[model samples]
Target: MCLFTETRIKFRLFEGCAAESGTDGEVVLGVEAGTYQVFALPDHGSAYGAQWVGLTGGTGSQDLARNVVVAAGEQKDIHKIFMDRKGTVTGVVTGADGAPVTGGTVAAVTPVIGDAGRGRVAIDTQGRYTIDFLGPYAWPLSFQTSTHAFQWSGAAHRRQSATLVPVTAGQTTTFDQQLALGTLVKVTATGSPSGRYAVAYNNSNGDVAGFIWVQQAGGQAIFRVMGGQQVKLQFAGGEPGQGWYGGTDFDSAKTVSIPATGEKVVVYPYS
Candidate 1:
């Protein structure tokens, strides 16, 4: 009997004020390559869009393949895909007790000549680890934890049998992030702004989440209230003017929560 592994990620390619395409990524099934459907879903946020296809030419035995897409966010359910990958990797550093090692930093040394992407992922508590990595063939990788250091200065190979595989065209590889162990401050927000619109929850750092904008259509705002036990966060503010606007008050704004773990919040005000 033959065995294989598969993984997936929710990826999307956004267009300006238009329908966006979403992907299910690559799906790895242990079947002799012949032909399969690579599903690529493009959502108008109102209806179904299109589908993509890929061909796997397997001559039997363990092999690798590559698929290509014209657009982004399209999931490919195919019989064959990347038999080889050109990118970096991510992993966790644990103690002898099988515990996650915290405060670790992984570094990338792969040069563009070798086709290398910036490989970096923060290990969360519970020894969780992940990496935003890439490697065309095999690339050297270096890692450092709070107390220990490790190196896989070898070729970073892409898994052939992954459910979520990268396309030859637009690729974004996600390595499962697992850290040895440490205090994690996962932040979440709603109405966080990006571009000219206000998107909630711009939790980049523990400091600022993100920003928003007000148009002539209507004024918008966010709200956040405070509590005693492990303060839950929320945002509230006002945009009375038209065109573009912002805020400059704590009352126009509210207090937020500090997380013991990751958090989620949403608050906005309008005129």
Candidate 2:
């Protein structure tokens, strides 16, 4: 006889416009009176895949076409969301020196479906990780470690150029990766408002590399990326005049180059 550890699966309720996480398999949401389609997502690392409410199987967000009508001061109960088992991906993570790398994570993203079908898991002491549940499709995997810059599969730095791993239902696929050293970039924001602020970095391919929140005024955030990569930064919330770091939009935004020894930059008021 063999015993396997059980993974706890959490649920999330989505209505195409807003989404909220559920506790203990139940969710209560407050929305304006309207007609909407509901979608349910199992938390990452679960053995079950996401699906639309009222349907047992749905491949994408577009399949969430069933509508639930809501009126003023009305309360409704959506039927139980049926979860289906999805594909699994298991792999080992090693450093450039060819040794097992511990204390990191592996993540999966289905670009076509966006965040609706994403999953992640932590690497164990043996440098092994498993994304127990993911939609059956081609997905790009991201390997992240403290000592290395996060890299997509095939050692590509950006998602657009990374290799896509194919997955099948009720099956497990193996992928191994060796991380490369990355440059740590620190960003400090001054003259920020008293609330939280979002800072994100994007590549020319329009792919977001990473993001962190600045909790207070003059707070700092940090991320790692491959050296020589040109990326743009975006700041959101906290003040009236906040947008792209250097320009009004992505196309016109100024780019910063990451160096081998790392770099530091400051975001001033209105910039």
Candidate 3:
């Protein structure tokens, strides 16, 4: 991700009134005793980021305005915040034997901030892929392919140990990874409304390995997963607070063993 600094600041304060920063990038606004959303436009002006403020405090996030509260006759001071910039990543995928991996999708996965930094790109026949509009952050990137195999730059197998890659604003970073031969499992689901269904897997310690999302065709959906390891499946979509193997909620989602044979696993939702 990138960072952009602008001299002028514009804000949509507390419901209706709008304010602009002076030459020194400062603004004073009189607001009522209620929460308000603060939105600003960057240099590009295509995207807007927002933060929320209130008489008591404020909260913020990427590409979103935060909430703020104000009390009666109270004064508040706001600080200058940095805006997120964009970056691009280009790469290629290959198999364990250095052969091109075809017909699979590649994703730049980051363990930080939960899946917020994850971006995906399709692998072309020649195994080339690109993930763009990424935020500038140095973190561990795990390259996950369609078969749930992880790889690192200049490695031949799944990346158990990886290093942090730095991405700068408005710059392109090249990262190529090789996939290892892993067990395969054919997963299908049943007894749910027709829509896109996902089967997510996590390790024993509850860390996400990968997830397979497929549109359900005729009450059945077919997807593939790397097998020979213990994985837990959390069914997303169709219904809520139900369909877990041994529990009643999505948080307590079920766990199953994908045998070394890489056999098929069918989920019977609400069954």
Candidate 4:
């Protein structure tokens, strides 16, 4: 409960002189994701080299630097250690020559996340792009637009936002997209037969229930029971979790594989 024990953590970004030079800029530091205490002296050729890292593991004390301590009541910016250990700022990527480039590479220089989490996405025909992942590692990404390339290190963060970068999920981000591009697939019931059916969709995991249509869009629609095994297409009309037919509480859900790129199957149900 003593204010004297209050620890101040500071972080510094190693950016580039992209203003003058046109090379791939670099940002380097030693602070981990959390916080730390520090003393900044003039550069000594090497970074805060060999400094004692007393990080305790949690987001609070994981990357605490040793040998230096900020006085109580006085907070110092020790950001010199934890760089892009945050999120990301991405939209469209262009070339130095001001022309659109395709397949231009984007590498996370400071992995706010981890190596496996290093994000890389292809620039579309329109030069629009999105970061795959950005975590706690302040790894500034290196972008190449034709002969022109730059790094976000030296460049001041564009938006004066919460000062904290947040991660964007869903690796399947759309490129060159303005609106939500919904995909459409066609389904044919054929002589499918009448029944109670449940439809499932694919996601990062395996298969999950998306929408459970009773019949085809227009056939006899009714709430149907769903099971864990395969999606059931019970022929008998019944409420969800009830017997669609006889001994069969709900007819057996046909255990089958749903194609990834084609249309989902739709079964018809009788009244």
For model 1, the stretches where C-alpha displacement exceeds 4 angstroms are 1-90, 110-119, 153-271
- The worst-scoring run of ten residues by lDDT in candidate 4 lies at 1-10
Q: What is the alpha-carbon lDDT for the whole of candidate 2?
A: 0.60
Give the TM-score (vs. native) of candidate 1.
Answer: 0.23
Give each model's clash number: 74, 0, 17, 34
Ranking the candidates on TM-score from highest down gives: 2, 3, 4, 1
* Top candidate, metric lDDT: 2
Which residue pairs clash within candidate 2?
none
Please state every model's RMSD to the true fold in angstroms: 17.3, 8.8, 10.3, 19.1
- Candidate 2 structure quality by residue, lDDT tens digits, 1-271: 0001111111222223244454556666676787766544565456765444444544423223356677899997766655667787888989879899977768653221123223457889999998766666566677766677767887776655678777778999898888876767776656555454344454556555555556666667676666656777666663344656667666777787767565646564446
The candidate scoring highest on TM-score is 2
lDDT of 1 by residue, 1-271 (tens): 1112211221111222122223544333333333322323222221221222224332111123223322344443435332222233445556535666655444332111111222244556655554332323222233434432122222111112112323221243444322222122222223333223432221211111222233323333332211111222222233433211123332233344433233334333332
lDDT of all the models against the reference? 0.30, 0.60, 0.47, 0.31
Model 1 worst lDDT run, 10 consecutive residues = 1-10
Which candidate do you rate higher for TM-score, 3 or 4?
3
C-alpha lDDT of residue 80 in model 2: 64
Candidate 3 lDDT, tens digit per residue, 36-120? 5554422223232222322232222221334455779988555555545656667778876787777565543322212323234
Candidates sorted by lDDT, descending order? 2, 3, 4, 1
